[model samples]
Target: MFFLRMTAILVLFAFSCAKKKEIYYCPMHTSYTSDRPGTCPICNMDLVKKEDHSERSKDPSTLLRTEADGKMESKNGMESEIHHASPSNDRSSEFFLSSEKQQSIGIRTELVSRRSLVKKMSLYSSVAYDPELYSALLEYKQAIQSSGLLPESSSSLGIGNLQLRLRQLGLSTEQIRVWSSGQRDPSELIVGGKNGRAHIYSQVYESELSIAKPGLNIQFKTDVYPDKEFGGKIKSIDNIVDKNSRTLRLRSEVSDPGHLLKPQMFGETMIEISLPGLLTIPTSAILDTGVRKIVYVQTNPNSFRAVTVKIGKSVDTWSEVLSGLEEGQSVVSESTFLVDSEAKIRFGNNAHNH
Candidate 1:
């Protein structure tokens, strides 16, 4: 029986060795492999021969895997079931690290808590010149000039059809009167100068429209001058929301101090929305595994457990956590990837060590 068992072990070892296949792969894309040597189709790089580690791969721990986790080999002419991997149904993974290992890995944790999250949204914007408004203003001014003395009020100065057109173009009665009286030049609206101002328009989606208002300040940056930023306050929001884009137009007036900004000049703008008393964590703490978001939470001293979490909006530095954690829980914030890889190796996922 002893000899038979020894023979069975040798046969199994030989079969495992023969199972290894020769593979050639791209160095840049290691996962892209071919049975024979050739250039990688994805990158067109020469495939490098994959080195065989037949001698070094025979680890004693891998021989047993886990007695409880897998079916055992049959004793007499019995077949053994080899489990290629651990069951993936596990939702939580627990592991412990020595203080020395933690220190060497530079592991750091952050306390998850409710805090004010100031999120900034970057959107495409441009220095604007409304053709509709320009046309209406030009015709209104021409009619007033041709009709003799300009009336004191918008109701009288821009009389007839021109007055109705101006009102429908987002120009208030007082603003139209000011423009008619030369308090603000109509020429400055288009041919802007150093002493003039420029109009900036940004599109805000319906989901974020609640945070946008007429008084909120927006910071703009143009490609022409990367270092300089122009600031402006939203002066008006269109009552009409676009059906296809589901966005509304927000218009702001900014002074062209250097007179560099021109009509229809492409630029980007930043709008900040502040949410108070929201549960949040450092953005780096969450490991996105394509299907789920996982965060390593410290359960005890030097002991961490992987917890699946649901996250809301994420900014550059902070991410809002909606579930799967408490306010006082500490999560791995720094060196998360290193810790996660090591934990996988310790918890029977030794393939990750490669």
Candidate 2:
């Protein structure tokens, strides 16, 4: 009798211990496991396994969280009555996509002729001269020399070592003769003369001497005649670059006279150095993410997928697809962002789907 009582007591104690321990269930993931847990292993829901007949069914519709108290309640209502509240509703709420839809805004661009253009950088520039005072000095020399104001010995004063002395004394041939000729008004000569003779300097810019350097080719378009396209190849580039601006003054000759593009016009340039069979893609097909570039490839009419890509140089409307893509593959061009969103949600990212 004593042994029987002891065994019974031991069994009762084990049963009581098991009953006191709690279990857990995940709210979002119901298939995960927890042992002696307070919350679910996957979803953090309080796990309650009841022995009652009402609590044993796997029908998700029978399980509900009552609004009055935060606890799971089970009941059997008409199947049609709770059809609106399925697990799909939970997923829909989690991936709220109403705001993720693409806007109807349009991006505007001027289309250029389809040609093989090499990408290049172009900048707006101004026209300038090196020296401006030479014209004034030439006039001063001619006027004084013609006025015949100097002595006969001075008449032959030009074209020798003495001309250098005359120049140095601020006495141009014109200024000395304007005084000797007893001219009523010699202010122009006087202005040229100053106190003594001096040298004058000037600069000119008739034809382009900088942009036409040998072997360099440039294609340009201007905003003034935005529709017109111009092309040129470099004849020469100045060996001395501008110290202030650091620009290599180039001289280029346009083979086609139709490209009489004016100076100081805003333009874009391209230099095409062809490499054989470089992989490229239409720029329209790319989708830009802040962190990584992406694109959507068409798997089927109703299915698409998002793929991250590495990109290289871009020219006009095409981009160099470095990786994550292959040649001859089809992609969503006009609606890539919209399709990528849908693909992410379908593939279980829970991201917003457009």
Candidate 3:
């Protein structure tokens, strides 16, 4: 009988010692933690029990706990904290987090600012070979010669239908006038091999027609001479888009001093467009959810709101923001996926992060 009593006493003592000490703190002044619950000395508000998030977040069915959401006053005039799990019935793009949880997730942010943007386009090009185009140039050359001066100021009566035929062959009116001035020989269209000039044919997709204009400089690289790059300028762009391919044809003139470029040869070309003073952000900051773009803005110390934004051209590390975000706004830049995961857990299928 005495042994049983002694064992029971020992177990009771150990259990008492292992029990976790209760902690309390004023919600308005969280820095003040205490062993006993009462009014806080700093904020003079009633203390509330501190919650352990590890115990709360483990349950997948749990939504979110709104701490200090409201206060209920007692007969003694001391208030108590109310923490409740909210279903978040309405569609809201914002999510809130406590200070400690924010640190654990490694949340980072950057300001949206105006910066100069340079957009680059990469395209596959082929050295051109068109006998039809050569024939048209031959006719244009004869018309110019017959007119003697083929005066730029004169009407097109001397060329007959040759001007229209040249247009159909992709030569702009400006190019026809230049050739008639006797400066650049039109035979270069067909016999450029002797003069060291190569015609290159490349097409741009319909979506990029905004930047497709004549005179834009381009750089070409060919497999024949892997170490060299040739410079060229756009001579003409077709007025019509190819129905089957949805692409606009582009014709360019390249200088081949070493006679290295040959007809029907495969090559690559790059076009660069420089834009100034545009609102931009780090390319990785925008989240592409397969449809719309979303970015998180920190509205408070531990709060963030998801914002849908329209995407624009990207240059280097920065991407242009057409609409949605304003200059000098803070956006989440680092560890965005982790923050998004937490938001998904809180909102379930109703997440509007995109």
Clash count, one per candidate: 0, 31, 0
lDDT (10s digit) by residue, model 2, range 112-188: 11234454445342211112223434544564566487565655644244444434433345543543454523342
Q: Score candidate 3 by TM-score against the native.
A: 0.62
Q: Whole-model lDDT for model 2 versus the true structure?
A: 0.45
For candidate 2, the clash count comes to 31
Q: Show the colliding residue pairs in model 1.
A: none
Q: Candidate 3: minimum summed lDDT over ten consecutive residues — where? A: 82-91
- Between candidates 1 and 3, the TM-score winner: 3
> Which candidate comes out best when scored by TM-score?
3
Estimate, for each residue in 98-178, the C-alpha lDDT of model 1 and write its tens digit.
567677768999999988878787877888767777777778877777665544565464567787777666566766787
Query: Model 2: runs farther than 4 Å from truth?
Result: 1-214, 219-276, 347-354
The estimated TM-scores of all candidates read: 0.49, 0.33, 0.62
Clashing pairs in 3: none
Residue 150, model 1, lDDT? 48
On lDDT, the candidate that comes out on top is 3
- Residue 115 lDDT, candidate 3, scale 0-100: 89
lDDT of each: 0.73, 0.45, 0.74
